[model samples]
Target chain A: MDFSSVFLNAALAAVSPANLLFCFLGTIVGIVIGALPGFTSTMGVALFIPFTYSMHPATGLIFLVSIYCSSTYGGSISAILINTPGTPSAVITTIDGYEMTKNGEGGRALAMAVFSSLVGGIVSALALLLIAPPLARLVLLFGPVEIFYLALFGLSVIVGFSKGSLIKGLISGVAGLLLATVGVDGISGVYRYTFDNVSLFEGIPIVPMVIGLFSTCQVFVLGEQKRTTIVHDIATFSDSSVPRMSDIKAHWFNMLRSSVIGTIVGIIPAAGMSIACAIAYNEAKRVSKHPEKFGNGSVEGVIASEAANNGVTGGSLVPLLTLGVPGNTVSAIFLGGLLIHGLRPGLQLFTKYADVSYTLLVGLFIANVMMFVVGLFAAKQVVKVTKASTDLLAPIIMLLCVVGSYAIRNNLFDVGVMLVFGIVGYLMKRWGYSTPSMILGLILGPMAEGEFRRALMLSRGNWSYFCSRPVSIILLVLIVITLVGPALRNRRIMSK
Target chain B: MTKYLDEYLPIAFLYALSAYFWWDVEDFTADSLMYPRALVGVLLVLTTLLLVFTLMKKMRLPQSKDENSPFKFCVVLAASIVYVFAVPFLGFAVSSLLYAPATALLLGYKRKGMVFFVSILTVVLIYIGFRTVLKVPLPTVTLLGMTL
Candidate 1:
């Protein structure tokens, strides 16, 4: 409850050289993993968690936080240079960034990403410092009913992300919900779908499932295509003119607005950088005078998406540190790291472990600085990797995917799951289903179920409790609109 | 591959699957029965509806259809099944190395040497990284002293 000691401790811990070194290591590794296509910041953090188990809790947390921040920026490097995104978060970045590269402005785009990421990250860090405590205090008012509704609100996002036919997305989502039901039924202490496997008792491991779905699946799909290497001939920083001060001045407002939008979206549980970037891009386009220029190398689009995605790094940390709830996969692994060190998150973290929290915040700031420098210096080399032939890249990515999945608890079953999902994912792709919605469902299904069950239990089976609360009602309405509004609009247009 | 999944053959297959699972899980109680059974039931119903829709469209206007490559699909499906079965027994390194080259050749890889080299490297790197860095204690059946 005392604030003075916590702040003092945090400030001291943050300034420590050892913590700084760990932060540096995390940032470097995060950047490398994020720069490589088929690997994500989430996967990087998960793979890196085992290595941090032996360290002090503060050091371990700092390392993880640094990785979380840096890897987000790293994703844009690939998206900008190559048409392929290093992570899902960078998907929006590819639209304008790749176009910029095609227009022979690769170096400037890379520079813009680095600078905007730093600005966005720093802004979010400041917001985290200013807003987290007060917001956390407000969150403390939440009962099981509120938490349940919040979880539902998070899970309902799957409908929003569904592409093509909503039916297929619904099927995929239900499949994920079914998968989440496997292992022990938490409330009843009964096994639901374990089928007698000992490993199923603990449930499908999050790390492996995530790695399998995203990485392993990617490998199998890529392997199916004949390997064709692409060699890019983009100009380097020296060859390509550095972005002018006028350019930075012109885009400063766009960067700020996108960062704010991105951070807010990131704070919403389960809304990852992909959505943040997309939302930011849409908002920027909506407000821009020359919206038509967006997909054709618009600097506004690049600024909006790049800043927004990076801003997610700090915004995501708010829930994790405050509620012991992860907003996304990377934060989930970081939460695991904290638990391994015998540190209980939530209110205690802010008060008792304030020093550690401050240290993490400082580490994030340091990581962003490092990301900017590294991205600027190594933009040329990063671009060259994009040009590498698909044949060579595909096999290498396949190897990384296997290793990444295996690294998560060393389970061969997870590897198999990954391959199986990969094939399924490929088929789904060919069949016109959205992989993003499926992933969202897989991530949020269990949370939604647990909350729904708990809310029902607390309310003694009162179904109206969800609508009684203003926030929950609003979220429910939004979910409905997101799901049905699109369909109605499309139908109206078709009828005309 | 070009044919929509909403068709007669796939619909019939789903019906068969639903029936088989329904039988396979006859002994389980209501709690156990609810989730997967509901899922399978939905699959059957949806596929059946899709099939009906396709049939209705066909009735409206019959047209010539291209010959579907069911054989190629069966081959790929069979290969996947074999790959999963082979992985554990042959070891990840061995099975994956073979799997990549075999798949490449099947997908029509002309550069044999490049494919072979890439496959070998893929297996070696995965083995080293997983074993050394992540410390995955994968089984190595070195009866012939082929150390990985």
Candidate 2:
């Protein structure tokens, strides 16, 4: 493979007029969605996926990549303006960002956030371009037993990192696997749990289920809020919103360090952006000359939070593109998008589908550039989204959810599936069951099952065959570590 | 008792669900049964552990902040259910026209004009985007033998 030529071609295709237009449109939509309270990047990507169905595969992916990058940055707008983190990943930003707004340095805070996000996004984008191809080549060495163990490793990691009880997280994951078994058995060619329903024969649809879980579930949540608008008083942007060169020079090292931390966390499956930002914020405070200013409107605090969260955008895709594993919930949806377009992740993505894969990778860099440009000039306008009445937006979002679900198959049955899952997701969220863990289980269930069965068949039903392979044994060890390491850490914390 | 119900009832239901699936897998061929049976077995064990933890009071109960209105949630949920059922009969456009404002009002939005405007604008944009641009062939109404 001629690497230089491939890069050149991909850069050309990404910059084509149609691709650029999709990129810009995706950025604008991402900004609006991220600026609005309760409209998360996960929901934003899920809701807009149907619109991309008619697009060329490369173009559709480019649009989605653009949204993924910009939306992570967009949350900062509201976090600074309203003291409400528009996305969960922005929660740390609210500490200093809102304080800055109170101190009437909201414009300066916004400027720092935009610059830091741009730096973070570009750094992670570079990491994706450099790291994924080599990783894809390495993953090609995996066989059925190794792949099965890898899937288990991913599930174990998610369960270990789940926010609540380990038992509940495991239950949620197992239940998701059970639900994934509802259709015909792929290997055995026999119906397992269809119960004579034709819709069940194809199994549950991923797109509709995701729309319900992330999008419609949010609608029901928003319905419970009594406030008309998200925040009563909106902070006005001052003339100092433009980025000052002096501040950028001062915070360059902090932005770079936080972005690197975010990228590393993102590459680890299920260690989401919120965790990345929290760690980065702590690190920044520890090393800062003025640690006292951290919770009291420090630009360094705002930069650390914003940069790290945006840095997660590109890092999350590295695993998804190379190993067919989603690093987080939003990337899990991206996996669904790839499957919908008949593109598989892994070696084939680099070999057979190289054009599309490279286009998406290159397009991510362009998207980050566009996000910076948009964040610079239009952030004040985007903050207006916080004032838009949730009362009005809730029903409108519900309408989009219905149409988005139905558009996938043009089947009303899919919409019903979405509604059912919406209700189920709401109840699951209200309780403490891990929704992301369940979602990961749902996505990885079939892969795990198929590989498990295939490995057994190849071994002629000898279960010991899994232990014969080095990679498989390594994966098993990793899974054990993933499960036990967290408990040990907690125990140590308690003893301390 | 109520707090215990919140913790215990869901685990009990999960146990029952797992048991039914475990029993049901007996109807499958050996190959098909192996995977689901293993999964169900795992689920049964996990749910039992959850139940035991709750009984021992070892698990941290999820904190519930009851600040929001349950009445509004019910209204929206009911409205959504009706709207979905109405889509096939009333068509997507007509159903949405009625569903949007009615839902907003039912949820206690005071501004009637903005609700109507938002509702109408949403329907129009969805029509343009889904129908005209994307070619989705959204469900349409039939009036006097012609589909609208």
Candidate 3:
């Protein structure tokens, strides 16, 4: 809550001309990531990390923050113009946005998207700066048992809600957790699954694995599409500026409520932007006087969808920066960035690295403004990325995947790992398995194992100790809700 | 060509991999192997269930007939494998220069001249970005009298 020092330091760091330039560049790249179909924010961040290898930590992180924010906004451009969501968060945006586009309100739709995203971004960033410290303090009270259950909750949430069979998704997640154990066992110094390969001793490399899953697999998917055209036209409305103030004032309640929903969902590990947008859109439709107007060019739907998507940008960072755990796939990549810079995400971030942390917070606000400005001016130009040939895009992305895999640790073996995973990823996609759940399983497996072991050791192998603690009990209940709630909902739908 | 085996294809791969994974971790001590063993065991069982679910569904409903070619996918994938393996000996510059065009052609890009030009430019930019700017050593290989 102490603001004087953070304000001065953050001002100095974020306002610097070089940092501003990098932040601007990151926003542009993020917009591209968001505008391009199948180019996820996670993949973009992973691809860019190797480029930041030799830069200042503050500069690198601020740049990444810009990318994270603008990309969320960028997804709307494609969603509105092309009926294809550039990111999963924008999937809801497509319903109203494309409807509006078809109805010739495309300009107003894009404009509303930009305005709502700005409001959501600022609100979430403010929440991140003010609320994270207290949350971090609460997190400090958590025992190993609490953290272990939290990890379990994080791992199961995505699997439980996957598009196809929940059991099948859980299987994919289990496979990832198994892959996470492929290195030397930390407790006993025993080689677990290495099979005498020296590269396996350090564990399966996450960077290459993610690139394989998100980037290379996307390349394969693009090729499968054989798309000769992304969209025939953007509609004449896109050539103009944003929506009017009356339009903004009309939907103010939806924007504010969805921002709140987005922030809350973002703070919960693995609850993701898709959930945020869905809940927000559902809430908006329920509360609207013209509820039937939804799915047919409803401006309220656009506001709810875009605001929540952008709010997720700020909300996700809360759990990540304070708890040293990722809230989503993008934050998991951000965690990799933080670790790469030797800046751990918990208490040390707010105390020892407060200067860098505040700088990132302020930089995110600046990034939002930049996104709105860029979106207003360049919507016509940037939206055309969809028209880029799949043949060209796929090869270039695959090239980056190869180089990204090789660049990490300078290991060619990692390139092989990435290729194998790419094939596996493509097959998984074809099979409708949940990739993010697997990634979460891989990211959280070691943490879950280590914390569970520590909790048991502290209790002298008393299995009842975890259930006795309030935090652990609450977290266990949440995990139960995460798993059982979905199954029950599915059953209800089936019975109907 | 007559009938697609796409439904069983994924399950077949999963069964094979999980079987290998099950056999792979058999040698570790119980404490060390506990988590991985559980995961792989669950994967094995769940994959079996997935197979059963697919069969049951097919029995009740018509299976989707996939006419999409795996030709482009397999060719690009094989090219990537070659490019990755070749990079160690050929250097990133040479291998990627060769790889880019090959993949583009395999993907049915009709313009050969543009592909050739883009491939060269791509290699140069990558070399500068990774090798020169980032100072990462991208496996310099010696051919004839020159180190590249």
Candidate 4:
């Protein structure tokens, strides 16, 4: 419980030579992945996870965290240069960033993006360091009933926030929960749906599924597009591209405010970076002195979008580390990484694994600083990655997907699973069903089922036991609100 | 009618899947069957809701676009399936070298020389990273006399 000693140990581990090298490598790789069109940050993290299998837990986490931070920042490079968002989080950046590029001020837009991302990432990282440990302590108060309801609450919120039809999202989520029951039952030691396959004994392999859903599915999408290059003529960055001191001073308040907005949004489960940036951009526009100049080459617009998305990097991890609930898709994959190393989330992360947890926290802060340094010096070079042919990139990414899935347990069956899921993911994406909802369901389904059964057993099958605990009641109310609030809002809009 | 088929067909598929799951869990012990049955029930209900909503024309799902090139997507997907199945037989490196450029050409990339170069480079780099550096034991080809 001594904060000083814990932080000191974490500091020592984070700065170790090996961890530092991993952080730098992760930052560089994250930038490349983020700058390339059709390559998302989620896919980047999922693709590189198997590489971290050989590393120490703390070092491996730091590497992945570094990727999570820089990739969010790296998306703006393509947004500024070619008007194509390298990641979904950067979609809003294209509004004003491309305008600046057309006006021969691409360098200025890039500079503002880098600086705003630095501010947002640093702020969120600090928030994660300050908020997670104390919040994790609350896990001690949760019983099986409370945990069960909490898992349900997470799924409800995801369904509410899903992009398309609510019914489709619910179906996708429920189907994922059903799929999670395939392995041997935890309590009864009886197989549910394995059907004599030995690989199904331990449940579906998460890493391969993740790689297939996020990475290989993307390969198919890119192949179908038939685009040779992301952008025919990418604007060149010049020395004068750097923002002036006056511009930074003028936009400092906007950067800080948007960063705070982004961080808060990030803390809310399933409120992803795209939403965060959209909200921040709107807030920035509302507060700007010259509202007429908002969309057409407004530096504040670029700053707001970049800062907020980067801010989401740290904010999204708080719930994952503290409560075993992922805040977004990338953090969901981080949960997979944590579990892969025999580490569980919640109070144990703070008590028994304090050293590794704190190291990861401190390492995130360093990664943000590293991202700023890399974004400044390497932005020009990394922009060229956007020019790489999708034709060539597809096969290469497919190869990585094959290797990543197979390397996890050295099983060829896992590779097959990856292919099957890859096709399934493509079909899901082509349809309106949400992939993230299904993934969240897969991650939380077992916990929900196990905890629900245990709580019922403890209560001797009394359904009223769920209502006995204050935390369980609160979670149930939250779930109802989450499910109903969106529907009510839609009704209001339609009525108008 | 065809416009709504996207929603209706998926619902039909879900109903069938749920029925299978419901029947499959019949042999499970009461304790083991409880959760799966509950989930199957939930799925059936959700699928029915989706079908009703689609029929009512109340759902606002995005219209499906016909712009995507199905031929290109199918070719790439089929090639990938073959590549995965061939890995254990032909070895990872040889299969990749053959698969990458061929797939690229199939996808309409014109520069054959660059495609070959990138493909070879990809195989060598993966070999070094996975096999040599990480010691992942990637599949190796057994020739007539030796394992390469």
Clashes of each: 9, 0, 0, 0
Model 2 residue A440 distance off true place after TM-score fit, in angstroms: 1.8
Q: After superposition, how far is residue A63 of candidate 3 from its true place, in Å?
A: 2.9
Residue-by-residue lDDT tens digits, candidate 2, A71-119: 8888898989998888888899999999998998999999999889989
Largest lDDT belongs to which candidate?
A: 4
Question: Taking chain A of candidate 4, what TM-score results?
Answer: 0.96
**How should the candidates be ordered by lDDT, best one leading?**
4, 2, 3, 1
Model 3 gets an lDDT of: 0.81
Error of 3 at A64 (Å): 2.9
RMSD, every candidate, angstroms? 6.0, 1.9, 3.3, 2.0
Return the TM-score for each candidate structure.
0.74, 0.96, 0.90, 0.96
**Which runs of model 3 end up more than 4 angstroms from their true locations?**
A1-3, A102-105, A242-246, A249-254, A282-300, B1-30, B48-67, B142-148
Place model 4 in a CAPRI quality band. medium
Model 1 chain B: weakest 10-residue lDDT segment is B59-68
lDDT by residue (tens digit), candidate 4, B107-132: 99989999999999988998897777
lDDT of 4 at A168: 82
lDDT by residue (A1-496, candidate 3, tens digit) is: 4679777878788889878988888899999998987788987887777666566788888888888888888999899988989888999999999999888888888899999999889889988989887777776788899888877876777677666777767877887787788788887677877879999998888778877887888777766654544556665563345669898788898999999898888887777899899999999999999999899999899999999988888899998888765677788778767766878767778777888888888888988998898888787689987876777667777778888888768888988888888887887776667777787787778888888878878998799999997788888998788877887997899899
Complex DockQ, candidate 3: 0.46
Candidate number of the best DockQ:
2
CA shift at A265, candidate 2, in angstroms? Answer: 2.0
- Per-model i-RMS: 6.0, 1.6, 3.1, 1.7
Q: Model 1, range B1-148, lDDT digits (tens) per residue?
A: 3354433443464467566555555345554555456666766665566556567663111222222234433434455557656766776677677767775566445688988888887677656745674366654545378854
Candidate 4 on A103-196: residue-level lDDT in tens?
7788899888988998999999899998999999898899999999888877887888777777788888898888888889998998888888
Query: Pairing residues by index, what is the TM-score of model 2?
Result: 0.96
